[model samples]
Target: MTVAVATIGFTKTTAENFFARLKAAKVKRVIDVRLHNTSQLAGFAKADDLAYFLKTINGMDYVPEPILAPTEELMKFFKTDKGDWDVFSRDFSALMKERKVEKALKPSFLDGACLLCSEATAHRCHRRLVVEYLNKEWSGALTVAHL
Candidate 1:
């Protein structure tokens, strides 16, 4: 079975559209990769709220996987540097390697799992780096579909 990788940011989507998109994508679970999931800024995407909605509305499991997130300090540095993706990706990639996420990652969990964050797009999200790193580490077997 192909292990799919999908990325989504809840900020740009409504609760209805968010669940609909996951359902449309046939996602079985959502692995939240945010460092701070309960921030008031998250609004509907707050950890508890998001989990409740995913389970009740979409019949999907919600998992908080902080290992896939960049360190708060790193994020601060990135924002301090004015949203430099190059620096962010470089440091975040190194962090994943140090954390041995590949060894910890359960391929079965990713069969229909989507990575969740707050960025509107994967272009600048560390979740994208995580997906790419896993793809490379696992010999490119993963099919990444950013939602």
Candidate 2:
């Protein structure tokens, strides 16, 4: 079976609660796809801090892969697409493959994995695009859950 992916929003959730829910879901690792791993949220700023909390405290693996960060070329193309979500989606799928998202998924291959970002709503973030691309192109069975 394909690995199940989830997206969790850490916007207002406390670290403790977040970890608890992740544990409950049996998440083996969390992939932070945010362009900026640093969070405005006081406790989640540094990747090291997040890693420590997830690994040392919650016993989960953490990987920061910013595949959704818009590059210069991507930005330019986006402007041409004129906010066409489908175009953005198609391009992102290609980018993910080029970036070897499959390789990145290796760690979580044996267990459930979740992506994380700052936005409380998945639909409002680039994560939705990523998830949709994975679902369509990579045949990824991902469910986005807002924390």
Among these predictions, the greatest TM-score belongs to: 1
| TM-score of each prediction | 0.94, 0.70
Poorest stretch of ten by lDDT in candidate 2? 102-111
Native-to-model Cα distance after best TM-score fit, residue 32 in candidate 2, in Å:
0.8
lDDT tens digits, residues 70-137, model 1? Answer: 89789888876686778778888999999999999867778889999888888888888988999888
**lDDT (10s digit) by residue, model 2, range 80-104:** 5556656666676678778766556
Candidate 2 yields a Cα-based lDDT of 0.69
The residue ranges of model 2 lying beyond 4 angstroms of the native Cα positions read 72-111, 140-147
Query: 114, model 2: CA deviation in Å?
Result: 0.7
- Which residue pairs does candidate 1 place in steric collision? none
Q: Please estimate how well model 1 matches the true structure, expressed as its whole-model Cα lDDT.
A: 0.86
What lDDT score is found at residue 89 in candidate 2? 60
TM-score of 1: 0.94
